[model samples]
Target chain A: MKHVILGNGPTGVVAAETIRKMRPHDAIAVVGDEHERPYSRMAIPYLLEGKIAESGTLLRHDRNHWIDNRIELVEARASSIDADAKSVTLSNGEVLPYDRLLLATGSRPVRPPIPGMHLPEVVSCWTLQDARAILDRLRPGAKVLQMGAGFIGCIIMEAIANAVGKTGGSLTVVEMGDRMVPRMMTPKASALIRSWSEKSGVEVLTSTRVTAIEANVPHAGLLSLVYKAKNTKERVQVTFGDGSTRLFDFVICATGVAPAIDYLRGSGVEIGKLGGIVVDDHMRTTAPDVFAAGDCTESVDFSTGELMVNAIQPNAADQALVAGANMAGGAARTRGGLRMNVLETFGLISTSYGQWWGAEGGDHVEVVDEAAHSYIRLEFQDDRIIGATVVGRTHHIGALRGLIQTGAKLGADWKARLQADPNKFMDAYLATALSLA
Target chain B: MMNSLHIDASKCTGCLQCEMACSYENHGVFATSKSRIKVFDFHSTGRKVPYTCTQCAEAWCMHACPVGAIHEDKALGAKVVNETTCVGCKVCTIACPFGTINYVADTGKVQKCDLCAGKPACAEACPTGAITFVDASWTGLDRMRAWAEKLDTNAPTA
Candidate 1:
């Protein structure tokens, strides 16, 4: 069988390898739009931080990894898919026939509708090219203005902070939400993160929005015209929604991201309301013989029982496995996508799993120590833990994940004990999980 | 035949020899904090349970690794992290359900049990036989045989 996979991100790479392992002789081709070797976008922050070279971001260190696995790498963007003909047409007009197809075209950064947002001084920290542009602009004492404080935003902020900390630069982060990481963290948790970032010398402004950006001329009147003519130093004057302006060396928009599915408009595959391709438990889309995974697909949410996009790496990998196996004429199913996010911002680690925000009618318990910068909140539904949010502590925390994933019942006595003191979760987990085992 | 590390928690003495041995084998150090395998001291029940990477068939750390830093060692059937490629993002440390993979602050890289490339220093250092490297397929054989011996079918009476 011939398999054609789109988007050489982690999901596509993993699915291609899975197919190769299962059906060794099957012809496989992976299509990537980027110029660089297939690399992980997750490592872009590390690259910006000077933690690793560009080559270190490559998915496989071995030069012949793809060739050794007998998988072909096609460097081209997919234009459209002809489901009836079982063919995919590349932007370069090359047509490839396939017995199976996977759509793992991950996500693209969402560019908000702010005036002058498309200027060269502003870039989204998503791709390798973007990283290079940001790095070039980031000089000693550069004034960096970052938009958004969500998961990706916080990661980029941390990297930029580290980079600028060496040169005595300044970073100002603006978020529209009331707290940082509003989507993934609770209010109290986000407040702690904001304070942590502040303590690290990063100026974080929540509940703020940038209204407009304009190329800044050094002087406003006649001198400004002369300065514009010989504008060697590039800077932008950003207008805030509150009628205030600030000058920045460069602006980074990590506002948000959406699934890169514009090319699939005419395709027979069904796009869900969540703006991702809809797939079943087996990862099969509406189009016959076509599967979708990664950040581009809306799978079942384990907590809410609704189709939602849990666009984290672990979920992407799990979905890719199922898609790859089923595409290779094997049976595989996901237990539904679980929302998991673990982040380290300025050396403070925090994690949230499942429905971090408590479920409807669920009993919730929280233990917070502001001075110690430690907090733990457990959301319980009936006698089972459905979600959890933890900050500061990292040892054996996976037991929280273990209990949630296993969906084990704590019974009455254990439940009351946990409610009283959530720190005893490890003991509770050992007791309950062992009994179940 | 592939070999696996089998643990008998009941026989553990919490001497931490396995931890010291593991750290020395991997890091050329004697620091227990640097060991890949850790012995959890349950102060309440006074039970010490030694736990480390199970080297799962479908390892979460290997899959969750975006840069492909973690790979299966074909010879030892161990999932090992390539430090050169690891960005120290600590994503694998969180993905691991058992919390066996750890981030080393000194190196900024994650470390896990690689079974010492099949030698298994922990198993070799155990004094009470709480840990042992045995055939993967028959890890439960000794216990099974022990229980079978208790049946005493030759007695011919209850």
Candidate 2:
């Protein structure tokens, strides 16, 4: 059997290797559009911090790991899938036939429709090449501005903050949302992160948008310009929505990312509302012999019983395993994945698990310490713990995930006790789930 | 010089990104239960300690392996397990002072951290600069540098 895996990121790599393991003699081909080796987007922050080199971001340490494992790594962007012919046509006009195909094509950074966004200085910090470009523009005391404060944005901000802090540079983070990571964090939790950034001497502007970016045409000559506008001596000027302009040495756009499923435009695969390929529990798409995983595929959000894209690496890896197994004629089923996000920004950790926003008419508990920068919100449906949002406290993170994932019920008594004292979660778990004490 | 995983427990957030990366690299899965490097969460104290084999020079696991499956890779100073030679004896799992090595029921062999052949996934996946693969000889250098920089260079030569 011949297997073709698309995208070649974490999902693609895992799928290809899994197929090789299950069916050792089966021909496996992994296709990636990027020029560099398969690298983890999660590690890009470490690369920006100078903690690790470009090689460190690679999913596989050895260059020859793929070859050694009998997996062929092909560098090509799949233009379209001819499901009828069971062949994928590459941009270079190369056609490859496959007995089974896995579409692990991941996401592409969303470029907002702001004017002059295509400018060299305005770059999205997603790909390795983008990291290289950002590095090239970074200098000691560079005025760096980042847009968005979502999960990806916060991570990039952390790295940029570290780099700028070392050189005594100024860093500004702007997010159109009311707070940092608004989608995953509660209002109080997000405010805590903003306060932390402020305490760290970083300017964090929330509920703001970048209107336009233009070249900073100096009014005076080089010497006069440097002397007069010493602080705002950057090359590009950014116009905000509030009719204010500021010059920045570099601008990183971490606004968002959309699944890279445009290649399946005419592939007859069902695309979901979230713009991800719709797949069943077995990771099989509407198209026969075609499976999808990773950021490009939409599966069940276990907690909510709704289908949404869980673009996280762990979910992607899990989905890929099931996809590979079923593609190889092995029976496998995915229990689906819950929405879980754990973020560390400027040393303050925050996590959101399952439906962080409480279910409809559900009982919820909120423990907030604004001054301490600690907050915890537990959402419950009936007697079962459904979701949680924890900030500045990671001790109960694992236990919270367990309770939510297992759909553990905190009986009436335990629930009443938790409503009074939220810190008694461990006792509730022991009493309800484990039946201990 | 041999290197070790220098961990600053204070910097850990218990995110478990390291666990996912470790399992993916070694077992071809994202299950943290199969991960060799485990993050021990001290709930009451709110401390996260990423525990793994320190690859002691005088290794107890190596001495306790009945089938001589565990051998040190001199180049990396990591005691690697030869899966083919392992007899599922699990004697090394008990002999190790640190509960780092364990027996895998599926593979019927004991698995532990071998530093990923000098490139550990846990250290690589760490985001907060907490877990650093540093030179074993100077694990305390980073801390010492912070303290040394406070010296008054021109205060008094005498």
Q: Pick the candidate with the highest lDDT.
A: 1
- Candidate 1 wrongly placed segments (more than 4 Å): A166-168, A218-234, A412-417, A420-427, A435-437, B43-46, B140-158
Clashing pairs in 2: none
Q: What C-alpha lDDT does candidate 2 achieve relative to the native structure?
A: 0.76
lDDT string for model 2 (A89-161, tens) is 9988999999999999899999789888888888888899999998888777889889888988886676687
List iRMS for all predictions.
12.2, 23.7
Off by over 4 Å in 2: A166-168, A219-233, A420-431, B1-158
Worst 10 residues of 1 chain A by lDDT: A428-437
Error of 1 at A357 (Å): 1.2
Cα error of candidate 1 at position A262, Å: 1.0
Q: In DockQ terms, which candidate is top?
A: 1
lDDT (10s digit) by residue, model 1, range A1-437 = 99999999999998998888789899999999989899998898889888899998998889999889998999999999988899999999999899999999999999889899989999998999999999988876778999999998898777787777645488999999888998899998888888888988899998999999998857768977886765445489999989999888889999999999887878888999999999988889999999999999988887888888767887898788888988888778777777888887887888888888998889899998888788889999999998888888666666676677768689998889899998777667765754311
How many steric clashes does model 2 contain?
0
